[model samples]
Target: MKIFGHRGYALRYPENTLVSFQAAVDAGADGIETDVHLTRDGVLVLTHDEEISRVSSGHGLCKDMTYEELLALDFGSWKDPRFTGERIPTLDQLLDLLEDTSLILNLEVKMGFPYYPGIEEKLLEKIRARNFLSRIIFSSFNHYSVAKIKALEPAALVAPLYMEALYEPYHYAETFGAGAIHPQAGLVEKSIVDACHEKNIAVNLWTVNRTEDALKAQDLGVDAIITDCPLELITALRS
Candidate 1:
């Protein structure tokens, strides 16, 4: 199974920052997963929450803040003093950074809670320009967003994320032409994995940090495992 960094070895570095992503690459993660939000100035930025308060020194919805306004916030200090200078990175910046690597880019469109109109088009445009359609996986809690992505680009890969089990999820993926299903790590089971595999739908579990859990998912024959500590998981898997 492939191992992806959940927000870039998130346990050791600030999640979704450039340094964190570099750490993931240095630690030998196969890929790095990140969340995306469109700033008020129409710049796509990496961040998990709709609000900047959780990850940075700023207090406002990301959609309400311009990219310039967000640059002033200290995105890393909330996690550690040494990482105090880490700033939020635009998606363009991140793509430029990783364009040369073989690392898979899993972009979780942050459409839950607050929806951004035309974000699908914006994201699609950038990925197409970067010619990353083959390497990137677009995932979201909104199934409609997942559908939109597939509709936008026939060659684009999409995985719908779910916290709760859906009725016949493998079929759901097939109906939407999704390449994979991203379910919560705790929500995964051998039966679901089996069902998904039978339909040739890859199962990528999310937010798993424990070594035992990663091993279990591997034994279950899931396609990939997403974790906050890719460094530790990579070492554990190798050992």
Candidate 2:
């Protein structure tokens, strides 16, 4: 199973910062996961929360501020003082940084109050321009967003992210035209893994932080596992 970095090693580095992403790659992550939201100026920036308070030095909703305004804030200090001046990075910046890294990127689209219109289409265009369609998987908690992407581009590799357990995950996959289902780690049972596998859909669990949890997911036959400490899991798996 491939190991993905959840929010770019949220534990050890500044979550969603380029430094964190590079750290994940350095730690042997097969892929990196990050969230994206369009700024008031329509630039796509990496961040998990709709508000900048948790991960950035800025205050207020991300969508309400222009990219230039967002850039002025320190996105790295909250995690540690050593990373104090690290600014929030644009999606374009990240793509440029990881161009030759051979790491698959999981870009999760985020939409909340004070929304920007046509974020899906905008994000798709950027990805296409970067020619990262093949290396990236588009996932969203809203199945409708996944459906919309599939409708726009039939070949898009859409994945539905679920927090609650489903009775039959394959059914959810089929309904959304999703090639994968990313569920909360605890919600993923053997049967859920089997159901997705039976339909040729991949099962990817999120936020798996420990060595034993990753191995447990691997033992259950998950296709991929997302973690904050890829090195720890990789070491355990190697042992």
Candidate 3:
């Protein structure tokens, strides 16, 4: 199974920051997963939460702040003194960093709640402009966003992310022509994996950090495991 860094080696570095993403590459991760939000100025920035206070020295919804306003916040200091002064990175910055690498980017689009209008178009436009469309796998908890992505770009690889168990998720995924299913680790089972594989749908589980869980996923024939500590998992799985 392939190993993807969840929010860019998030267990060791600040989540979704450029430094964390670079750390994932150094750790020999096959892919990096990140969350995307649009700033008030229409710039696509990498961050997990709709609220900025959780990850940075800033408050309020990320959609309310301009890119310039967000650039001033210390995104890494909250994680560690060593990471202090690390600023929030724009999607362009991340694309540039991954331009020459072979790492696959699983970009989770943050929508609904405090939604950014026209975010799907904006994200697709950026990726298309950079010619980075082929390297991305778009996923979201909101199935509408996933559908919108597939509708907008028929060639885009999209996946539906869900926390709760759904009846025959592979069928749900097939309805949208999704290339994969990103279910929380707890929701995965060997039967589900086999069923998905029968339909040629890849199953990528999330937050699988424990060694036993990773091994279980491997035995279940998962396509990939998205974990917080890429180095530790890579060592455990490869060793």
Query: Which predicted model would earn the best TM-score?
Result: 3
Superposed on all Cα atoms, model 1 deviates from the true structure by an RMSD in Å of: 1.0
lDDT (C-alpha, whole model) for all candidates: 0.91, 0.87, 0.94
Listed in order, each prediction's TM-score against the native is: 0.97, 0.97, 0.98
Off by over 4 Å in 1: none
lDDT of 1 at 84: 98
lDDT for each residue of candidate 1 in 1-239, tens digit (9 for 90 to 100): 99999998799899999999999999898988999999988999999999889999989999999999999999999999999989999998888878889999999999977889999999999998889888999999998998999998988889999999788889889998998999998776788889988888999999888999998999888899999999898899997
Model 3 TM-score is 0.98
Candidate number achieving the greatest lDDT relative to the actual structure: 3
lDDT of 3 at 117: 86
Candidate 1 vs candidate 2, lDDT winner: 1
Provide backbone clash counts, one per model: 0, 0, 0
Best first by TM-score, ranked: 3, 1, 2
- As a TM-score, model 2 comes out at 0.97
Write the candidate numbers in order of decreasing lDDT. 3, 1, 2
Worst 10 residues of 1 by lDDT: 184-193
| True-vs-predicted CA distance for residue 20, candidate 1, Å | 0.5
Please state the error at residue 220 of candidate 3 in Å. 0.3
How far in Å is the alpha carbon of 193 misplaced in model 3?
Answer: 0.9
